[model samples]
Target: MSKKRKRVSRRRLAGQRVLAHVGVHNIETGEYKPVTAARRYIAESGIVPPALVNVRRNEHTTDRFFWGEKGLFSAQYAEENHFLFPSLREIVDRIGEENLFAGLEALASDDWEEMEEYEYAFV
Candidate 1:
């Protein structure tokens, strides 16, 4: 059974990412040497990862809980689109984990499982 607990106020879901799918087109035979090369590029370029940007101003503010990295927005795109790493682990690692759960006394539900999954997932 799901246990009910007091809801914690969060600005947004932790480790949320704005996914940007850069489409690919068929190029010359020489350009697409191996199909797997594209996969390698995706893995390395970090486009697939949850790339985050601080959005909030007043970097000195102490009350803010989350990193205020503003994301890049195009005039054509919707405002809801934001960027983040592929998972929470990356976000925590990028921004010190200490800040993430600093005030919380107890760990959140699924915290352990989420961490485990993040650890095993490929880069």
Candidate 2:
């Protein structure tokens, strides 16, 4: 018999801000694509894990991706679920995506190191 998984409620902590949006991007063409396109690209390209591309959402938002054995996932999501995959945990520990991408605007911007540091600090 198969074990049923419990459905967990998605809740936000106080002061938490919702992301404006999430989507994929084509680096060469500089076009933003839907999430569905990301999945399709991963399947067709057969890219290796840990390979990723970045996309700029706006002046304040930049999205980062990590290619996994299963497919592409946001760095934040990969960190949150790293416990489920050993490879992911190693990548998160080594790359520190939160620190790496924070305040780093996309497209030739290298000011990430100048930004003020902040912690996740979930309650």
The Cα error of candidate 1 at residue 74, in Å, is 18
Task: Output the lDDT of residue 57, model 2.
Answer: 52
The digit string of per-residue lDDT tens for model 2 on 1-123 reads: 999975321211101112111233343313545344455566677655645545555566566665655666675664444334345445435656565344434424332222222233211
Q: Tens-digit lDDT track for model 1 on 13-87? A: 233221222222221223432324333343455443223222222344211112122322221221122222234
User: Which residue pairs show backbone clashes in model 2?
Assistant: none
The local lDDT score (0 to 100) that residue 95 gets in candidate 1 is 65
In order, what lDDT does every prediction score?
0.32, 0.43
- The global Cα lDDT (0 to 1) of model 2 is 0.43
Clashes of 2: 0
Q: How many clashes in candidate 1?
A: 12
TM-score per candidate: 0.25, 0.37
> Candidate 1: which stretches are off by over 4 Å?
1-13, 16-91, 104-108
Report RMSD (Å) for each prediction in the order shown.
Answer: 15.3, 15.2
